[model samples]
Target chain A: MNIALKEIVKNKVRFSILGSIILLVSLLTFIISGLANGLSQDNASLIKDLPSGQLYMNKEAEGTYNLSRIDPDIQEKINSQQKEAVAFSIQMGFLNDESGKQRSVAFVTSTESKLFQKVKPGEIVLDRSLEEEGIKVGDTLTHDQFSGKLVVKSFVDQKKFSHAPVAYISMENYKEIYRTEDMQLVFVPTAESSLLFKDLQSFSNRDFLKTIPSYSAEQTSLNMIIWFLVVISGMLFGIFFYMMNVQKIGLFGILKAIGLKTSDLFKMMWTQMLFITLSALALSITFSQLFTSLAPKDIPFILTIETTLQLAAVFLIIGFIGATLSGIQMKRVEPLQAIQQGEV
Target chain B: MLTMDNVRKTYVVGDVKEEILKGISMSLHEGEITALVGPSGSGKSTLLTIAAGLQRASDGHVLFEGENMTTMRPEQVRNIRASKFGFVFQFAHLVPFLTVEEQLILMLDVSASKMKKNETKQEINKVLQLVGIEHRKDAYPSSLSGGEKQRVAIARAIIHKPKVLFADEPTASLDSKKSNEVMSLIRDLTKTLKMTTLIVTHDEDMLRYADHIIKMSDGKIL
Candidate 1:
């Protein structure tokens, strides 16, 4: 109840020093958190907002239409039993714009999707970054490294994969470009099935993407980095606080002899650390916002609240644990020794 | 009333046990100023610490109001220390950054009293005025002279109106003139408040102000 917030305020130098350190830590924590968040969002930003709860794809196709062998019979079979099905097809290929560079994403083609309606046949609908790269609407792009030519149509939202941007196209046009005979690919609801879909592999979007080896493998690599940074930082904070406590033995001994209880002293120290973490988090987030503003959207950056909270929580918990360990050292300080030795 | 009955303190260095206080004992009555004077390493401060419940005695007991102080739990000891005992030390230990008035306020902040904030302020101002540093209430410790800082330290100790005020070399760092003046202030404060005060010091000159004198040598009261 007697938390001395005023005492902290009064000692502006110590308070500010502590707060500044905490703020720096918070900022670093936030940056790492934001980057992790941005990576995840960039990975599935557009797909996460899909209106349908699940995506349906051919079984043999590895969860994506690009790999799926679709038959209209199976698409028709699934549609008859329940809600209407949206037959969509998507593939990955290079579009050599006027700048003559190959860029990639699994270009989705859906007659049933608003995303696809933006692109016209033989025309490219690429990310706006392509515009800055000297590829404009009137420019021509070579598919699959000069395999063919297509006109640049317009810019849509930039969804990235391994640093490549995705462009949406119509199903018929998609087929026309790829020249593939399998035009039976489609999306259906989770529950609907019919005999016509008999001999067909159906999958929702989440599972459909998981079927892609690259999605799972890419996530694994990125996740390792994020987890490492969080864990290492947490440990680093814990150790730093612990050492600070250890270095103040004489001071603590003096305080203890003068009747400052271990509990009270530790609470004060923890509050100091909390102050540090909070300021750092705010600063880091602010800096990250600055970073986000300067960079293009196609950089695959996505920052979210959940990421910040998760990282900050990590720092706080680590710092507290460090405090607990340091507090235990206070028990070793004998007032008699301090007084007799004149240490404090 | 407070009494130290044959208390002792010892420390173990690696594998060796070193004895510090050797069966020290005493009694402090109300309105008395006692100085524990001794050479360096004589354990005067250690004895005082044991008597104040800040340090546990290796052997014997400290009794306050007929209760065994050395036997009480640490929380109980801390509770009493806050409400019944006060402290002053050589360094002025004023928390470095607080103004004089703010420093005095910290003494009462730890106590669980629902006494209104204004009452707390009144008591703090009263202590400052009594210490004759009311004019410097807004000043920080670093800005004050040695004498003035000790005056503030005295004010801090008595602001809580503790039953016992323990000072460890209260004037050790001050010049003789400042030391005497500070000692006089402590004597006056004790008389005014009718509280028991025990000061440990190596400065022999401080003895003239003490109502009771206890000479300590090698942890023994001589």
Candidate 2:
């Protein structure tokens, strides 16, 4: 006889209230987490999409990627030493279409490398988002700083920088627009980049992402909210079970008096917790995944299966801790008290 | 059979160590309803709980079938309490969520009974009928009348065929008519099952059902 299950089945309304709260909390966490990930992708997908490697910048620039100017000689030496090394520069700029409609774009140029979209001097490759704005192949775009007009050659998928679609242009056009020959960063696709350079500081992929001004602070606040929700859910689990346990104190005492093991009472509470958490998590994950797919393209929301699974595991563990803490009173119940307290 | 040899229970509040059961000794025989009757604060309920293994005595031994339950580990005592003893409290104390039938099934599970599934079901039905509650087997405690709930509590207590039945003010929550019905049911079941029974009650009318009535005052039997 599974009394735990029977109790849940018998008092559907009571248990559903707890389950709904868990579902709502978990759903909120998932949606917020998705937004956080989406915002991250929007902020730096151009750099993040690249494989893990070391990014070298001028040591004197002090963690600001734009201010970092790699010396051409050192860049040449490292490029020769590491064949996979790629030097790149990104500057937020705008482009005017044939109709003179201006659109924000990140002007990006990299040395000959397979890691980036390659474009000829007269042509431009753009992020697919520009295509949504009606820009297409053969459309000529003009920039205020550059003397020449750039014809759109093609569009690539999901390449963004500093929340702007990347416009992959040739080194010649990039130099003409920016009027500087020095690239801002050099990326080497190797784990061991501990080799000393004269004026460059080496950073891992994650450390380099932090060089972007608003990225860490934005992620920090969003992550704080996500964790706060998780903590609140955990506390809610504890408090809900605490309230239920308080109501059942007399019943637990009577059960104790009747020779029910204290562990059995704990088991019952845990069984109920596991059932509620799993069911609630399953529903929330499904809804969040649906929301991920159904959300408008403009909304920055990305929920991955790995993240959802990890959060689900956390919710279960936190709920277990909460419910178990509340059940401490079960072990403390005196059957004599229940015997005297009048009917449960 | 159950025996309490010089059992004492002391509870401390602040600095004072108050003795609830002071060196009490008693024995309950099989097929007899042994009533512990006394005034409030006279420790009849304390004695009953100690003998029932609901609480541990501060000193001395509680022997059930020659085993000293007082000295046994808590888990060991709990095992005996689950298997060998049945309890009916002042309130019906039926788990409000469980139906009458589930209540007995829960009891059988708590007792760790090895009866086959069909046999357990048969035994639950048999006990429910004995308590005149077979008709209410599917009813939750909330829907049952006071008498009916008490009957279900009794059925749950005895469904596993315990060696001893402990009733503490089992009729306290019911009116005269219902109290009489519950007391009569307990008496008949104790006799039929040949189990030793211990009861604690202040009500004078309930004493007639007990085969051996012990009056206590100041923690000692009179």
Candidate 3:
């Protein structure tokens, strides 16, 4: 008979109110989630793009990547022991174009490896974002700290660090500008956790991301908002169903009196929950994906199918828990009591 | 046929044990209306509920046919209530969302009837027509008048062709004219279907339609 669906169709305004609330909440959640991912990519795509591995830095640096300096001897030893290992260093710096306009960049230099772009001492590769600002291949750029001029060899896509375009320079140029004889870190791709060295701490790829101060703080706050929305939506289902079940206690009792199974009542409530949640998720996913494609280039909004589906699954499970909890009252209702309570 | 052999029901509140039906015993014959008439708190309604399997008897046996219902499990009792019994309360108690036709269909589903699609529709129509509300089969409970809602409730109750029909003050909420109409309908259905019927009511005017009238006072038949 599908009494649940019939009730929803008959009382359109009532169910629509619940549906609209879920739609708005899930839509807001999707938008915020997209912004959070976008900001995360903007803040540290350079390290985030790296394959799963171990990162070793000086133990005395106290979890600060910039403060960590791996000795040249230790770097060479690890490099020899781990064939895929690479010693790398990054520092915030500025470059002046031929027109004398200064632009901030993260100057990164790494040992000869396939993991990073290999640039000659007199050449450089830059993130594509710099191309939008009129910098092109073969353009000569100058650094104030060094006397030599370097030509832009090419441009790479989406390589960024600390919200700035990454400029890949050679180890010789990096040492000349910073006057540092040692690399800041050693990265070994696909390395096991058991691999350790004296006077150094190893961090997994995910844990290494936490070493960046702005990355952790930003991600933590935004992730907290996402979880809060998820929980609020669950409670919304609880309170909303609680109220609806309360009003229909008499109806439930009457149905039970007529020999409807208790499990049947639970099924009815579950069917309604799934219907409402799936509908809202479909709309929110469509709108969020549309926003992803049409949003301004500077908005930094990125929503993927994987994240959307994961959140939708969470909403369904939470809503089911909420509705089931509220339905506990239905099991306790006595048909005799309801029958005595006058008409439903 | 249904029989009660010294059935008892007691309610305990805090430290006090109050007995509602004290050693009640009765029997309902096939194709006859048995009315339980009593004043308020006289336990007539309690007896009806116990006999209908809506509640448990504190002591003694409720035998339907040859099986003692009191010794059966709750699931078994519920199955009997779903398939072998029908109920009509004082109020219509129709599901507000379902139309008159859907109400009957829901009852058919609950009873687990094996009627096919066409047979189910024909049965629903037949019952609605018998209840004199065939034209209002598409109407929701909210739009139906009090009498029409009761008629639909009656149709829902009998759609499954239960063996025993239970009515608890079925016409107490209706006017005198409407009450007589409902009583006459119940009497006609009981004889026409050859089913055992038990009714609990305080309205003496409705007694003329019953074949057996048991007047109860202080939980005992007088």
Every model: iRMSD: 3.6, 0.9, 0.7
Worst 10 residues of 1 chain A by lDDT: A188-197
The DockQ figures for the candidates are 0.28, 0.87, 0.88
Candidate 3, residues A1-344, lDDT tens digits: the string is 89889988998898888888888889898899999999888888988899999999999998899999999889888978999999999899999998999999999999988889999998999999999999989999999988799899999999988888999999999999999888998999998788899999999989998888799999999999998998999999999999999998888888888899899999999999998899888998898889889999888788998999999999899899989999999999998889888888
Candidate 2: residue A257 lDDT (0-100): 80
- Candidate 1 lDDT over B127-192, as tens digits, reads 888888999989978789878888887887888788999999988889998899889988998898
Candidate 1: list runs displaced more than 4 Å.
Answer: A1-46, A51-89, A94-105, A109-251, A283-298, A304-344, B6-25, B37-43, B111-115, B215-222
Query: Residue A252 CA error for candidate 2 (Å)?
Result: 0.7
Restricted to chain B, the TM-score per model reads: 0.95, 0.98, 0.99
TM-score of each: 0.76, 0.97, 0.99
DockQ-based class of model 1: acceptable
Q: Which sections of candidate 3 miss by over 4 Å?
A: none
RMSD of 1: 5.3
Question: How does residue A226 of candidate 1 score in lDDT?
Answer: 59
Give the per-residue Cα lDDT of candidate 1 at A61.
Answer: 58
Top candidate, metric DockQ: 3
Angstrom error at residue B107, model 3: 0.4
Q: Candidate 1: DockQ?
A: 0.28
